[model samples]
Target chain A: MGKNIFRSLLLGLVMVLAIQLVALAADNQFSGVQITVQMQDHSATRAIQKLLPDFEKMTGMKVNLVILPFSAMKEKQLIELASRNATYDVIMLDYRDVAGYGEARWMIDLGQYIKGPLADPNLKLDDFLPTGVQSLTWKNKLYGFPFYIESTMLMYRKDLYDANALKVPENWDELYANALKLNLDTNKDGQVDFYGCTLRGLRAVGYNDYIYNGFLKSFGGSYFDDKWKPIFNNENGMKALETYIKILKDCGPPSVATFGYEEVMQEMMQNKTAQVIDATMLGTWLEDPEKSQVAGKNGYAMVPKGTVQRGNSFFGMGLGIPVFSKNPDAAYKFIEWATSEQVEKSFINEGAFMTRSSVLNTKEFKERWPLFANLIIDSLADANITYTPILPEWREVADFVSIAVSTALIGEKTPKEALDNAAAEVEKVMKKAGYY
Target chain B: MTKTRRDNTPQWILIPTITFILLLTTFPMAYSLYNSVMDTNLLKPYLGSTFIGLGNYFSLLQDGRFWGSVWHTVYITVSTVVIEFLLGLGLALLLNREMAGNRITRTLILIPFMTTPVVIGLIWRFLFNYDLGIINYVFRIFHLPQVLWLSNQSVALKSVVLVDVWQWTPLVALILLAGLQSLPIEPYEASLVDGCTPWQQFRRITLPLLSPSILMVLLIRTMDAIKMYDLIYVLTEGGPGTVTETISYYLYVIGFKLFYTGRAAAGSYILLIIITLISMLFIKLLRGQYQEQP
Candidate 1:
């Protein structure tokens, strides 16, 4: 697997290097074009914004930015897409949203633009992470290009692990054992000072349910069968949920069910938790010396597995041109420029979520982010996109499952009861959509 | 009579007003009603808006989650309104008294209702956080068990109700206080001259005179409470297994997230009817009280 990754890495480098020279000499054709782009107000997007002036200078095109929080951004995009608004030329593209947008034909098919003579060779498609590129493609046509990608990974306190003479867990059993041993009571207080584990239990598709997908895939449970029938209530799913509940109840914080990504990450920064298994993006916050109490004292590893051999999640966010855009060529130019490797490298200190393999291979990146750079690339190389299938109804399906998982967490329903109910509802949704 | 009034004076003034009103109000209702009878889901673009009369309603009636949300909405509305009425009346009566700092106290009472609902939800969410909230912190300090305010399903709806009550009781109290200030002093003076107790005067005169305002409060609060969405949307997000999902929240999920526009419109009409019936009940009661006295 490592050798294969290396070969692809070499091929991407050669392609990028060959194209870089050709792209730098290309003409700025659409100098007067003004394009507005909408994006989520996230750390990476803020970092990307800093390079907007340079792009403006290089392309001689005016760019407008409309940034909003995640949910609001999605809602706004939906409203605009549904109404066929020409207000935004370029929009932030979530990999999960690719199917919905593509099927709706609300996005311009970038496969046409990203390849052949129309393509900007410096756009460097091969340089983007494999899963990142694949997730943005729908029905064998490329719809967008990911500029940032992250996957689930284990983040733990190195001091605690070393003091206990523990090795990083490779599978579920070892993880559970370590959690048990690390549930510590310090300061001679009867109450536990440091929790052994914490995972989000907030009832939202993108919150707790995001992490839960890793567990589901690890246990050999798929959300659907070969024929698109809901089968997640099977024994494998129940086991996955049962084990999830066991970890949170036994070693997590008392308010684990109220935990979201922000809260779990907060617990780590406050030194109240020993470990968390969440998106690799969390490394940026947890390793920040100004914000974190445990900065530079953390260990990183791949997300532990279950009885099955597969598990970690890979997802991405990118940019795409709206179908109604007046300046499709200019919009594509902006996307290509924004995701280019040079722009990605310039904003590394702000914890830019790099998309290019060349950036990952940089010695500066490795030295600066020693905690997560290596582990992230390793996980990315083997990132399993099939763990969470790209369906047009993903938002709705994942939301239903999230509610069920939350129900089990709060002791309102058993894992079997909740998962079974959710499976039935999801099946109904599929039937209603004529997917049966 | 004044220049015979018919020469070139346009009769089209009412046209613009009528058109504006209909576009603002009637058009959406008509469009949604039309959608409710058809398969208008955006997700299934292939399945065009085919006329499936009563199909959406039939499915909604059979939908277990829809019914659960209806029950949840009723629980939140009834609990918050009832609790707010009782507490609000007590507050109105107290403020009606000639007590020290009464003016300042009255102003302070308005603070909760004056704050935006979203901000209230955010503040209360922090205050009710199970591990780190101020309420739980105080409970820990007092050696009392911490409550699962947002996490536990059985308690979540009640927590939402409590937040609603906290934010709205002041509005109810202020309305009742206005009614109290407007009450005639003659009956109470007459009762005092006749050696009647304060309770007797209040029970006989004050309550009867305040019935209209009380009914008004009931009408407004009930309609507002039934459409409760913002608070729970930010607080529990219909969590701990759909326990706190109100009818409006469920309708939102169907319309926006699921894109089952037909089902959502149908479900919305059902909620509209429920609100209409409850408002009519309050209005009828108010009419009867006025008829008896007038």
Candidate 2:
């Protein structure tokens, strides 16, 4: 009787081993495939690195991630993509670049895989934020999938506002008024001892133009018309630029002309400046006790509303398969795994940003980020994807506008004059590009 | 050896070297030359990047911003090279004497020169920062008015010059020191016997003998100053409304940032021409002075 019982136990063990082997075979279809992905260093990418071993194991494929600093990543990606043989199977793309890359035919269109036989049933593409999805779409075809997104918001010193009995600003006028009232000379020096605010005036597309575009859009002005003619010299655009210049020049730090994200964040955190109207991701850093001095003393609000609508400029990053990729199928599989619900949910504590609405709409997410959760969701809804022109010549156009903004702020030219000159130059660029 | 084999040996050996050099330098220069003449905008294929025959060059010539950058480049080059020369000469003369700790101090002064240009730029950028920088903090403590070293349009370029001088004057001084040491003791002995004063001796003998080294310094520094984009990138980024933008920085924006291939190529070729002309002019002037001096 004992010998018969031992035989039965051995038989049960064999049955379990066979069942697990069959499941592994079914799941690991691309057992020999390998793909490379080039990405920028971000919290999300860091989290993905931690979670990457699981992806490689589950898919039974080798994955190589090449992370680089942002500017280097952009330049290196272009160099690789522009070559006949792109080494990276997948690459990170800025939302503004989707149109350029699509037009160049450098990136493979992912719409077919999203809808075709390779499509994962559990992969809810519809769950991504519509703003992100819309930004990634070019000519009605999805060239990429959004990975991280940020929108413009207002961050301010709550303690300072309370001490001065100042209400939170709701619109451009109110923001300007608050800045003026908060502009203090505590030591009675002619120079402002305590600045009211700081705004980035660094002359670059990704620097000053990012902030200035919001004001222009909120005023119902635009860089170009439907026909691609320069329209930012209009009355609304001029007024927006003028107001932006006045606040920057009169109420900010003496070095306000040079302030980028780093300077602005430093000033706000060190309590040298009272407020900054900038990116949504900064809210996390502001509230972190270790990284910020004004941690508990900070307040969050939407970007100030303009006359027609509030200006919430959207910025997003996405991933795409290169056109020259040898392992397109494997590349697609990797990206799918990267953007899946499980991966996005892991970003909750791993990284602070997510592109999916499902991940962002959870009660847990709202509870975790009590300050920015609701504001981010609302701003994402209102975020203007085309706040600045999203064309291939966008860098050139944005540079012109940023320089104009700087000159106007420094009293070298009136806002109207600066905008007009920029408009003329932009017109020349458009005509040269055959946009006429 | 057979004439055929003998002739073929040198040609065969040089073929790879010649081809490599051509590929390294001439090919890109020629390619840029070709691109400069076409309407080669990669982004706008609709325009059909056909042969436009100097359209980019013409536009750049007429471009005010382009001219502004050219002027700024000249200004920065002159300012940096001159300041570096004066300071370097002073340092070199001082170090030429027999003194304690001369060797160690000489080695230590080279520390800045040994650093990578990008790292040097980043370091100076922090020091020159207006709000959080030690420079401003010190000024505050001493009751000195704080100066916006980099943010102010007028002072921005000067601050760039200051950093360049700080990092490079040591190199210039070292180069001149070598020239100083190599100088014959006869000229100083002769001048001493003639009862010539120190200033007169320096002017008549010391300077004329050091002309080669001085020429070397001017040439290297001018070329280097003309290519002064790295510091501007980290410090001012050609900011305060394009007041500090040099030709290299402007072309960088045009080429890498704007991606206007043909226009950027034209701008690059224009810069190459400017650099070559200035270098030629410098060599001619220095050599002329050297030959003409009694």
Off by over 4 Å in 1: A1-28, A116-118, B1-16
The interface root-mean-square deviation of each model, in the order shown, is: 1.7, 2.1
B46: Cα error in model 1, Å: 4.1
lDDT by residue for model 2 over A255-297, one digit each (tens)? 8888888778888888788899888877887887887888999
Identify the runs in model 2 with alpha carbons over 4 angstroms from their true place. Answer: A1-27, A185-191, A350-352, B1-13, B45-48, B285-294
* Clash totals in order: 0, 0
TM-scores for all predictions: 0.93, 0.92
Error of 1 at A364 (Å): 1.7
Tell me model 1's lDDT, rounded to 2 decimals. Answer: 0.86
Candidate 1, residue B123: the lDDT equals: 98
lDDT of 1 by residue, A148-193 (tens): 8888789999999999999999997788889888888976658776
For model 2, residues B1-294, the per-residue Cα lDDT tens digits are 656544478788999999999999999999999999987655544456788899999988999888989898888888888888999999999999999999999999999989988898888888888877899899999989999898787788889888988989999999999999999999899899999999999999999889888998889999988888898888888888888888888888777766678888999888888889988987897878778856
